[model samples]
Target chain A: MLVSLAWRNIWRQPVRSVLSLIGLAFSSLLLVFMLSFQFGVYDTIKIGALGLFDGFGQFQPEGYDDDPDISKQLPGSQALLAADQIKGVSATAPRASSFAILANGDTSFGAAVIGVDPAREPAVSTLYSTISEGRYLEPEDSAAIVMGAGLVRNLGLALGDNVTMLGTGNDGAVAADVLELVGIFSTGVNAVDRQITQMPLARFQETYNMGENVNVIALRGPDFNGVIRAAPDLQGLAEAEGAVYLRWDDLQPEVRQMITLDLSTAMLMYGIMIVVVVFILLNTLYMSVLERTREFGGLMAIGMRPAQIGAMVWLELVFLSLLGAGIGIALGAGITIWVENVGISFPGMEDVLGQWGISGRVYPDLSFFSASIGPGIIVGSIIILGLIPYRRILGLEPVSAMGAA
Target chain B: MKPIVSCRGITKVFGKGELAVHALRGIDLDIMEGDFATLAGPSGSGKTTLLNMVGALDHPTAGEVAIDGQPLSGMSKSALSDLRLNKIGFIFQAYNLVPVLSARENVEFVLRLLRVEPAERRRRADEALAEVGLQGMEGRRPSALSGGQQQRVAIARALVARPRIVLADEPTANLDSTTTKELVDLMYRLNQESGITFLIGTHDPRVMEHSKRHIEMNDGQIESDTRG
Candidate 1:
């Protein structure tokens, strides 16, 4: 009976109740969409960065990442092939990288050169498709090199130009080679374009006297999350090969820190939004209770306990919050799913997004967990804050309430 | 017979210090069971204040009120509420029917507070409404009923619980002469038929004429007491 009375009472002033409901719904919608967009942007950044060279994650010699010395090389390509056997491992590429000096007609600059198998490198990295001039290295094309556009510009060289490379080999001998620049690629990433140069693995090994050893084994998976799930198994494989596994977080700590900072700032804003919504609900309910003082007094005069009156007010709030949250969840989820499918783009922000390692377009995350977070916080807040009106009802004196005009 | 309600030197003061207004001054009174009595007085004459004290709705400053041998002064708020629910019913000047409830629901409200089963509460509420000539109008809200009908519903609500005492404060003040007479006649009939005691606070001569006993007040003191 109390429940029935409370349910009917909220409708006594239909406009006021409806307005409060709309406010609650709007808050939930904004919260859900905001969180989904933030997570989507993070996903975009991870994919873009991992797509650069290290695909999803990598396995390298224990200290090779910090000191890319030719001497600290992996045993063989067998470990890289073994890692490819793991579930969800799309592909793997083994590469030997070293810093060397390249000179074209007296213009000499330092460049990071990578030795990769022509056929298998494309399976792990998208660098092959980014070629702007000439062609990628052929399987038997000895002394051939594919360099970034920035590197070519720095050395004042063009396609078909022969560049001289000078470096020390793994056996401590002078390693020298004159290589033809067969390809000029532009990755749009300033760092990669300015320093990276790739060549066929066999020619690089013969020039550097490194035999068949590779320094790093890069692994690619379906997506960022799928790669993270496969990390433990990949780590087990790396341990067997006496190598260390580096997940995206370990490989790109700066990106991880950037995401953490952004999420904290977003959560702070979400907290303020929740507080504002809770206050609005409190004000609406407090006014409603005050207006019905005389009615409450009448109930108390007829032997209704103060506790029962409090319970009635609480039930009314619970019903209103649940109704609003339900509607908001439906609207939020619908919009998120649509955005996820079609994607949303920030026009005129391409340069800024590119600087942050993301494309202008983003897809909102529409998972069940993401959709429920907003409405869940709202419902929990309303039930907890319902105490405001309950305390007010309990404090009312029947005689005073009855006499209130 | 023992008095169903008794008051001893009851004093009630509103506010405190220089702002205090003494609404009741050391009044003593008693009414036996089944008595139909009226406390007749003009406005600000302590009639309503005394009624409030007797109903356990307000606490006396320096006295005590007892109903059916239970002292009300020292009881907890919940205990006092329980006392009112079990032993007393009230009819207000404003009718005080819960506006959202239908006529039958308003009458059954007290039974619900008393934890009475639904079937018995409905049966008693229906019977009480029928007795007050509101049988077919049980489904109508207070807003849909006439002033006279609303007052009748209030009367039925007060009597439905079968309490020992029914406290009425100007229950007929909002009705016309004909409606007032019909309401008075209904209360008189209920008092006679069920042996329920009635303690009414009002200055209306019509209400005084229907009662067997009258106590008139002036300036927060009893000026006269009479019985036919």
Candidate 2:
């Protein structure tokens, strides 16, 4: 009976009920949308970070952090063997790197040219699939090269266009060459895109005048843990070859940093969402209880106990919470589904995200738990705020409440 | 005869120190079961305070009150609420029916609080509304009824519990003279027929004339007690 009475009382002023519900819905919608966008960006970073550059993990020199020179290269043979021994290890590639000036026509720009065995490159890096034009590197072609999209643009070069490379060899001798652009690729990272290229390891060896000298070796496997687990064996191989072992974590600290920072930012935004939602719900429920003081007092005068009155007030708030939560979930899910399918592409925004090494079109990617948590938080906040006025109602002196304005 | 209500040197003070206001000072009263009694006084003459104390809605500051032989001073707030629910009924000057409830639901509210069976609650609510001359009007809300009709609904709510005492604090104050007379006649007949005790506080001469017995208060103290 009291439940019915409380339910009826809420509808007695339709405007108030609706306003409160709207307040809840709006807060919930904002939280859901924001979290979805954050998670979308997070997924982008993860894909870009782990895709072309660092596989899930890497093998590197033991003391590679202090001296990142040719002497710090992890021996390729044992790392490759260890990777093969792991059950789920999918693919591995070894790399050598050097800095040079890429010049085409009158344009010249500094670049870090990475050297790899073309046959093994595709097994480890998504670079094989990222080619926009021409073909990927081929092992027989020592002079062929894949230029970064931004680097190609900066040097004013096209596929099949010949560019001159000028740098010192590993033996401290001048090395120079004309290299043909085999393909143009984008890693999305501005630093990589503006100043990097991929070429055959033999070509790099020929240019550097070092018959077998490689500065670093990058490896890839199905599991990041598999790569990390092979580190000890990789170190022993490097010791045998008088080289040091290094891992991808040492090669790319930014990947680890980016993930950590993004998650922390998401947590900060979540806190802000909670506070904003609580205040809105508190204001709404406070006004509701205030407006109904007289009716509550009357209910008391008619022999309804204080506890019963409190229960009625609580039920009304729960009803409002359920209604708002239902609407928010439906709306949020609808928007997420639509955005995931159709996607939202802002003209210059793609470039902006690309500059941060993220994908162009923003797709709302979310797990069910991540998506549902937003609305659940909003509803939970409303219920908690609804209880704020309960103590006041229970403490209401019936005579004073009756006379209250 | 057993007294349905008894008060001994009851006092009620509001506020503290220099700001203090004593509403009821040393009030002593007792009325037997089945008495139709009215407390007559001017504004702020402590009639409402005395009535509230008897209703168990407010506690006396420095004395004791008993409702149907149960001591109110020693009871907890919840216990007092239960006592009011099972023994006492209240009627107000404003005809305080919850405006959202239909006349029938208003009467049913008290029975619901008493935990009466749903079927019996419905039947008793219907019977009480019919007795109040609102047989077909039970569906109407308080706003749809006249001031007199609203008061009758309040009366029905009070009687549906079959309580030992009905505390009516100026129930006819908001009605016209004709409505007041009609309501008084209705209540008097109910008192005579059912032998339900009533403790009404009012300054109206009509109510005093209509009541079988009257207690007059002056300056926070009872000045006279008379039987018609």
Q: lDDT scores for all predictions? A: 0.87, 0.78
The sequence of per-residue lDDT tens digits that candidate 1 reaches over residues A285-329 is: 888888889988888888888889999989999999988888888
Candidate 1: tens digits of C-alpha lDDT, residues B111-138: 8888899999999999999999998999
Interface root-mean-square deviation, candidate 2? 1.4
The TM-scores, chain A only, for the candidates as listed are 0.90, 0.72
Off by over 4 Å in 2: A56-124, A138-144, A149-181, A186-190, A199-277, A366-378, B16-19
In the range B57-176, model 2's lDDT, one tens digit per residue, is: 787899999988888877775677788788988889887788778999989988888899999998999999889888999899988999999999999999999999999999899999
How do all models score by TM-score?
A: 0.90, 0.80
Number of the top candidate by lDDT?
Answer: 1
Off by over 4 Å in 1: A63-65, A73-91, A117-124, A134-144, A157-163, A177-182, A200-213, A229-243
Candidate 2 residue lDDT tens string, A92-206: 6777777888888788998887888888778777766777888889879789899878898888888889999987777778778888998998766677778778889888888
- Give the lDDT of residue B136 in candidate 2: 94
Q: Report residue B111 deviation for candidate 1 (angstroms).
A: 3.1
